[model samples]
Target: MMPRLDSNTDPFRRPNTNHINSIYKQNLSKFQNFSEELTKRYDELTPTKKILVWILAVFNVIAVVLILIFHSYIIKSLVKLSDKWADLKFGHLLLFTLVFMVGFPPLLGFSPLSLLCGMVYGFPYGWPLLASAMFTGSFASFLVFRYLLHKQAVRLIQANEKFRAFSDILKEDQSLLILILIRLCPLPYSLSNGALAAIPELSAWTYALASLITSPKLLIHVYVGWKLKSLGDETKTFATKVVDFVSILITGAASALTTWLIYSRMQRKLEIYHSSRQQTNGDYDAMIFGNFDDNDLSSNNNVELDSNDFDADNFVIGDEDDDEEEVELDEVRAETDQADVTKSTSPTNSP
Candidate 1:
């Protein structure tokens, strides 16, 4: 082995540097593109969601800062408040439900309430307690929108083409699928509830059932708030802190990934559904952007073209009268030539 140390023939020869670099570049490019797409989609969030994000961010920062500055006083006050509210558990729940019901609209989202529940009751108790409030709040909102705000919701839906298109999808028998997809979408929960209210066909029970089905997603936000409470605990061991940190990280990552996936899937479904709607109506642009009435559609359909006015059959390639004149002139010239030939032959004989 020592005598036959041929570098070229060695099995442990280094791989091609160019090939490895090419593979690395390809993977890097793919990852960059994937990240760019996610960024683009995130930037396209609805105005409601953007507002919610801003509010949550500013509130969290201000709260954290104030809590740090007045830590002892704040804790003492909260402990006193907790003691007073401890025996009034049902009252606390009822108050939360009332607040949620009042605020669970496009103007005010339910996310903050969900987090409050988690921070107050902890996850094991908080999840179910919040779920109940959410259910009640959802049902209340549905009733309010369906009855009290019916006209306004209708006006809202009619004014927005996207909402109308989504409403059309909900009008179908497969509306459950559409509603679920919309719920799973990273859109504002209030918007979904309001839009569902605008649809007369979507029964109150149907909306309630759908909310129950999709309520599990609230747990993700609750978990975040619950873990955040752990951060303030001074008695936690190093191992506990590490576990909580990891748990928070994993939970956040999973929630984000799940939201992105749902958004992507919902986007594809919307595109397909919108395209089908456009095809059905045969108006791609107007169907998407224009609020067309049945009268307008019917008027457009009733437009008629008269074939006689076009007269396509009477179109001649060339001038027929000019051709006839040319043929007559040619015949007259031939006859004149014959007459001239006869006259010339007769004159020559006489001479």
Candidate 2:
């Protein structure tokens, strides 16, 4: 049975009518404004950008599905295959490494391959193997793109404002730190390689060093794969199982957090670069004078402007007074011309 509330000591007091109405109206207005803004932003995306966003979303969805649902089966199959071809494992690894080095399709991610290395060999072996493969692949792609498709890649990169801004950062002799930051970003390995290839000023040593610096990120993926191999053990203790699950979750979370932080830092740097460039290039005097040399201006018919001609009230853009000022200027000019004509037409008294 529910307790009844006393008239004088009611806990569930009714809200004020005016307050409730105001709150409801405020919330409704906020929702409508948010919906309108979201729709506007959606409409602003270019078709190509929209396609790329959709592709990235699909890729993320697929990755999440693979990790959550099919991981056990996938791990079992890969392990069985690795055991069956234990003798040929190293050779297959070499072949995959070579293919990665070629980087034919830049969208092909490297994480899956790194995980495979861990599944075949333990994390200790996997980390070194994946690191070597990444460094070799990066260097090879760098050389290939540098020699073969340099012009094409540069043109493509220059078309994107963000990439152009990043490239400008690379040109500042801070390539090593910038490249390391880029490597730490959540971008796919092949994509990063392609962008790095477009930087004409980036040295081979700096690229290799940056690759080495970010190689540790592969450890988390390799560890996840290694733990996955033990997940299917039927004889494992309950505590052991719990520990393994927790470790995997922690490692994955840490990797994601670190990657997000690095990516955010890169984005912030790019934003700062863009803002500084705008401030530098946005000066009214500089913009007006940039295309015209003083000599060129002297060669043309020059019109001098008086300070009094630029009244503050007359310069108010889009105001009624602006139009009135224009009419007044025309009348004044006509009066001056008429007075000059009359003076010239009148006979001189001295003559």
Whole-structure CA lDDT of model 1:
0.72
Candidate 1 lDDT by residue in tens digits, 67-152: 88997576455444444544575856664765467434666647766665666667767778777777777778778888998877
Pairs clashing within candidate 1: none
- TM-score, predicted candidate 1 vs. hidden true structure: 0.57
Residue runs of model 2 more than 4 Å from their true location after superposition: 1-71, 92-99, 102-104, 155-162, 284-351
lDDT scores in order: 0.72, 0.73
Worst 10 residues of 1 by lDDT: 302-311
Candidate 2's residue-wise lDDT over 34-147, tens digit each? 799877877899999888988999999999988789877866787786555445846566636653664533547566666666676767677776777777777777777778
Off by over 4 Å in 1: 1-91, 103-109, 158-162, 283-351
Clash pairs detected, candidate 2: none
Candidate 2 worst ten-residue window by lDDT: 98-107
lDDT of 1 at 102: 48
- TM-scores for all predictions: 0.57, 0.62
